[model samples]
Target: MSALATVHVVVPARNEERLIGRCLDALATSRALLLAERPTLAVRVTVVLDGCVDGTAAVVRRAPGVDAVHVTELSAGGARAAGVARARDLEPDLDRGRTWVACTDADSVVPAEWLVGQVLAAEQGAVCRVGAVHPELGPAERLLHLGWLARHSHAEGHPHVYGANLGFSLAAYEHVGGFAPLACGEDVDLVQRIRAAGLAVVSTGDDPVRTSARRSSRVRGGFADYLTALAVDLARAT
Candidate 1:
């Protein structure tokens, strides 16, 4: 088996029992995408249950086609690192050249054509495919999504990579030292590092990934609150 055939989607989850099931369904959908794109590609899902005192593990276990690993540690940074390591270890043949590691959050749902679209972007010469992630929307979730879209729209000039749905060639990830050990904004940090290394980053805006807004809502101060939060984050980063 070639390294590229061992593509794995690593999801770092923390107290996401309510959303994990939907995320898993999305993973299954993504696998179908892989099969459609390359019938022989072997796709795997790795869910790292981090600091989950809830039934997150059970949810993953019940979900079809998922490899769940429970890690009591609360650090998402560490959990993701461990998950990626486990994925690579499972398929020893997956060295830097042909393998790829995709990262997504357990609270997010992937598009049905997510994997196929990503693979196509990579094969089309994108070193790191920065995919867009939209907050799940509805009357109940409308405010949150609108807030997210508004704040993120300013980032239009640069391809925004959501920690919930991003991918990188194993070689590219290793070259850039993987995700930064930050409490948050790891996705943006990783993308910046990739570009700093002279790698071309492209986004799949045409096929966005949908992620639950449940977690975001917990901290969101309604629409106004979200805008304030975004301002603070951007200001701090700047």
Candidate 2:
């Protein structure tokens, strides 16, 4: 028999004032839904304001369900690492075997079942749950997003890394020494290490996160760049 574990969510943001409100709203809704399903489950959220010179902090501060809000100058990987540390510090009694760490972006909206799905995966012996992400975009970006989806679906193999929507048990995360301090590719790096260590990494295919499709993003080389590249390729093909 497996025991229910606490869920610690980390969101690292940089100048995401415009999207932070929506992100928090979606997360609060998801938390409510998760609590309804498992009244006794413990879920906490930490929003790290990475170099945010905007109202992102205020938004998180007023959010009803968030557990912590940290301000820092780091972006991408550094910000994420800080957020995870905040979660760890806030819960000093957290047991690696029973607690799970979940991560999402400031510009993304997750479904109500996001935490529930991750907890269930952990309880079932999965060390990590790599989830899917859908793009929220305009018409042009939507076309590119769909194209990417189709291309990925028919690609040679499935993706092994996705930071926007990812989760892992604390034990596995600690074993890999957590996210590195790079500005990009932290998600890929962490997952590669976990896989290299022979941890049980599974797919949370059903709960795809809704992430922004804007070309301008916090991370320099990320999904935004991929979409922009696809758009460029599309223009060249025309």
Candidate 3:
């Protein structure tokens, strides 16, 4: 096999000036770690900037082991779709069987073993893998999320979907017509589509991504807004 596998990472960032560096650093480290273990495994990262007005692009441009792509009017889904295409184009052959497309948000930091874990799963026959996203919350926010967790317990084979920490085979992705253009819930939409096509989309709890807990989210009614609304409701109940 050519280099065991080739993994491409895609990150969608709008104005993540504060968090892009950390995110990129973590990803760069993960790539190095994976290469160290499996020297033949190829890896590439693309940071897709969507109409950013801050230093997100600047940070990514200087970052090692990553490519930057700027777009005028792209959100979460469109940005990632654009990134996927760009990343694949960089590869010499773009072997569909050995190629993997992974995604994480610019506001999140993946673990050092993030990419390695995904590659392991893929090597063991996992077509799609979705990792968990833990918000960097404070004491109050943690307690608030506790109630939300009661109903959303992490169990084996849980269908929790998040674009910030998900990956799929190249062939499977193109087969699904690529990612849809949605402001939010694009991750879930893509997962559902993959499953509907009779593909295996499973969850892996190891080395879950750490995301921001800011109430003012990039996408309205997203994870951040969900936490804000929950906090409001809980405070009212108390």
Candidate 4:
């Protein structure tokens, strides 16, 4: 039996018109699966459009069962924090301890069991749940994918943290002062703070989300940059 009453999902987008649609579609499926499994739980998906100057907003508008917030901060951390605040505004009396805050990137496609897994982990007394991510690479990027897999681990206690697949109790999030306003590495920073505060953090390889492996990233030092760096290293070794 789960003790959680509500779950809020936050996605931050910046000129991701080409991929945000797929991301939301996957999220809709996950949301449906979660609701079907736990009929009493409340689920909300909010997409934060940060400094978008393209068709991204239109794509978000076409998606059903999702709320959108506009911000010009151009910071992933700021967008995420704004999304959470919007969720809180919608549920004025939300119980922080009993509420779960899940985060994912606008360019990632989450598995149908993503939300269910996080909810289950939260119910089991996990203050934070960090899942895994598998990059969606084209045939041309096979080497990059291979290199990534060779350097990454997919185990129960894997040492990986991604905003594309992270969830935490609202109580724990607030206690850590929430996410900082940074351009990148916000997910890692939040997790570090949570651990430093002595919260029960759960790292699982199950329900890995699929994110784009594009070289051009919206923010510096993001997954795209990491993948590019990996490719460079591979090139140097070859």
Candidate 2: tens digits of C-alpha lDDT, residues 1-238: 1575677889988878889788888888888888898888788888887767888778888888786556667747778888888766887887778878889998899998888788788878889888888778666466676677776552223574678889988888889999998878999999999999999888656678888878875567877888888888876876
CA lDDT, every model vs. true structure: 0.73, 0.80, 0.84, 0.92
Choose the strongest candidate by lDDT. 4
For each of the candidates, the C-alpha root-mean-square deviation to the true structure, in angstroms, is 4.8, 2.2, 1.8, 1.3
Sort by TM-score, best first: what order? 4, 3, 2, 1
Q: TM-scores, in order shown? A: 0.83, 0.92, 0.94, 0.97
> What is the C-alpha RMSD, rounded to one decimal, of candidate 2?
2.2
Q: What is the lDDT of residue 43 in candidate 3?
A: 85
Per-residue alpha-carbon lDDT of model 3 for 56-132, expressed as tens digits? 88898889768888897686788889999986678757788778888998889999999988888787777789888
The lDDT of model 2 is 0.80
User: Of 2 and 4, which scores higher on lDDT?
Assistant: 4
Model 1: residue 118 alpha-carbon error in angstroms: 1.0
**Model 4: colliding residue pairs:** none
lDDT of 1 by residue, 1-238 (tens): 1335567889988888888899888889878868876887778889988878889888988888788777776455677777888777777766666677788887778878888876776677776877777766677545555557766752434456677778888888888898665666667787899999998777657557776644344222332354457545655665
Better of 3 and 4 by TM-score: 4
In candidate 3, which residue ranges exceed 4 Å CA deviation? Answer: 1-4
